[model samples]
Target: MSKGKFSSGVDLPLPVNAPGVTKQERAYQAIRDAILNGLLQASDRLPSTRVLSQRWGIARGTVESVFERLQLEGYITRKVGSGSLVSAVIPDSYLKAVTDTRTGEPDRNESVEIEETPVRQEGRYRAQVGVPFVARLASPLLIAPAEWAAHLQRAMAAMKPEQMCDVEPQGAWVLRDQIAQYLRKHRGIDCRAEQLLITNGIRHSIDLVARCVLKPGDDVCVEDPGYPAVHRIFEKAGANLLYAPIDNEGIDLHGISDSAECRLAYVTPAHQSPLGVIMSATRRLELLDWAQRQNAWIIEDDYDSEFNYQSAPLPALKSIDSMKRVVYCGSFNQALFSNLRLGYILAPPELHHRILALWHTIGRSVGVSEQLGLAEFMRGPAFLRHLRRSRQEYQTLRDIVLDTLMAEAPGRYRISGEHAGFHLILWLSPDQDEDALVREAERLGLMLQPLRNSCREIDLPPAFVLGFAALTRAQARNSARQLARLLH
Candidate 1:
């Protein structure tokens, strides 16, 4: 073995005692215990074999053998130049074994629970309103692990030293490039990599933009009956919010207070949040013209556009903007599930530096390994295929729930906004009180969100946003029937 120090600078904890086992076995067991006990988390880099051998006063070959065993058993994943990293996918069997060793009882709980569903004290999984569900794509989930793992391994292997530490505040350049290309090809939004900034998610993107653009007490226009998070994000950034009601065509710009002196406008033009209305071309153009005339910035949140089932998704508002006043925000969290936390903002060329500077001031950036893995995933064919699969699955779930609703409460309720998006609006009559209805539904263990809760200035008819994407066919059917029973 060569007497040299580790090239990889990561520090890993080695066990103090190596009793009752060979040197190689001791090394493997210690590293494995650290991983299982959460001392070494997913994507945490393991030190080089040279370092491990030097630390333990063993031959480097022994450390290499231990690494090989762990890799073969799937406890660790190794790449040519990236060294080794703890695998994110921990096997249930391995977990059970570790638990048995600790407490002398094996862990038999292997059931997988969806993060979006809340577990009640009564021991039932309750699907809440505005929360995502994931029952449709089983076995090979949306982002296939085997495929993604291969790409991730490749990305890690190709990663350079400078790429790992002190990452760019705007995000990895490779991801930005991939996002720019994706926007051009899929969203019809033309932008260079220099004009894009990777964000944690839509909330983070909007917060950053608000800090950059709005001074304290500056007026900002937001869609009424919109995502409440939008209002909260702006409020935290010290902007005074103005309300603009949304119709079937999207946000009613005509209804906005003309005297509000709004400096910024936030609208979900593609499959409007909680309502599923696609913004009409005329309205989109009018909004862009308004932004230009008022010297205001339009934040176009194009979240969840990939799952559109109606027509091919309309060209984004940013695509047609001739005045360079729109900042387009998009999120993979909705499309790939909430834990992904990967989103991007396509800012105008002028605002790029300001956005980058704001991100630096925040001093928090997304994990580099995941960013690189996603960049690799987007550059391949799997991501598009995954979108197609999810769209089809969501459409089926939507149809099942819609059919159940119509069959159970034919003339009692009206449904709208079902032409696209993962959710539909269940519009109630004028006499029906939304608050009481939601409360009653909750008492019956059916989580229904009141549509009026999202409204600030506009008093609209009572309704609920029914998200069907995360539900299984049987769960959707049962839930719809239960809801229909409540109505009757």
Candidate 2:
């Protein structure tokens, strides 16, 4: 058909001469790559052997042999008169998942397969409407599906054959270039594409850094009531997790110093999880200074810096890190849909290749189509427009939660972390039993995440992190009343 090229989808290219590889082998490889890369989509019609051989300038016999191999491998189905069609069930679902060389296990598709994805007028993710979310987090409206689909279409259509064959482990250079620009503009971080590494998400970024640096029994510092998963990631890498209690300014510097042995620290300075306090500029400087002096790296998880409702959000900790001690981590999952699983790490120039080397050693990568599509999306003005709409919508939701809860039960509890993020902390009196409240809430058909879950050693007043991003007006009010009643 001679379809135009794209990263999300494209036409196969003719095989070029190789010193040792046979013409048959090269032809086979090209078709197989097309199938794997979604350049030949599920159930798409394939060109007739005669047409392909003539078009690609390959020998008729070699083209026929290639087709035979593809058919035998179930990559295509041949019907005598109907011509050949691509398999209805392709091995790779839009995104190619290669077998991990180390584990010998094929990676699972992270994105859900859509038989027919419908784009609503409001551009909501239809699949997430009633789906049970992981991590007790909620996503706001951050993407225009119709526009996103169009961008993806363009992304696929624009891919050249060479791109499918040569994938970068550090990430697609175009995507990294966009990210470098995005960070500089949005987060005030000054970095080049060379310093950026695209990851599956923040956890993946952290895991890679941990693997690259940590040895068995090495000490890693974290905010006491920080992201629980970060704690586990550090622990999984055989490092002893040390807790640095978070205060009003941010993770306590004094608490961090208690672990003179620690060389790595993870902080959520943008909006600390559960507690929701922006790390003060002074504290940011202090943390950066500490990391520089101690020769340690600070993992600054930039959570919810995009959705600040009060004032313009502060610049990211990484922006202030003149010492290059902060390794900035963030993801599109919270901003986009959860399954996007696309994130980035802006490491210091010195740490970039070490992290890249670890990424290379792992030999796992997010599919080329998603990367190219995302890069295309970010390259346009559409992303900022979508982000603005999302921020406005989430602000309205945040107001609803604040108003409903305040009117229903004044002074019953104090809310923290409400200035930013999809979730906020409902802090009850210290005497209140947080665990019992959580259990009672679940019994009442509501999920309440206990603050203790994020904390390792810091003892605090009873509190629960309340997620409200996806709640409708009615749901917000009803849930507020339900939670207010529980306090009684």
TM-score for each candidate, following the candidate numbering? 0.70, 0.71
Model 1: per-residue Cα lDDT over 1-488, one tens digit each: 11122322335445566344466655765786566555666677788889778888889998887877566434667899887877644434434444564675532322232122111211122223222222211212455668768988988999999997755767788998999888876676767776677888888899888988999899999998788777888898788888888886677788665567788999988778778776754466567667755778999988777876754555577865655678999988767755677998877755656777767776756899989988988888877888888788878878888888789977778888786776788888666667777777878767676677678888877888777776666777888888887666
Q: List candidate 1 stretches off by more than 4 Å.
A: 1-141, 144-147, 257-259, 430-433
388-470 in candidate 2: lDDT tens per residue? 87778777867787787788778788888887887788889656677787788777766776777777789887777777776
- Steric clashes per prediction: 1, 11
Candidate 1 residue 120 Cα shift, in angstroms, is: 49
Q: List the residue pairs that clash in candidate 1.
A: 133-470
**Model 2: runs farther than 4 Å from truth?**
1-136, 140-144, 430-433
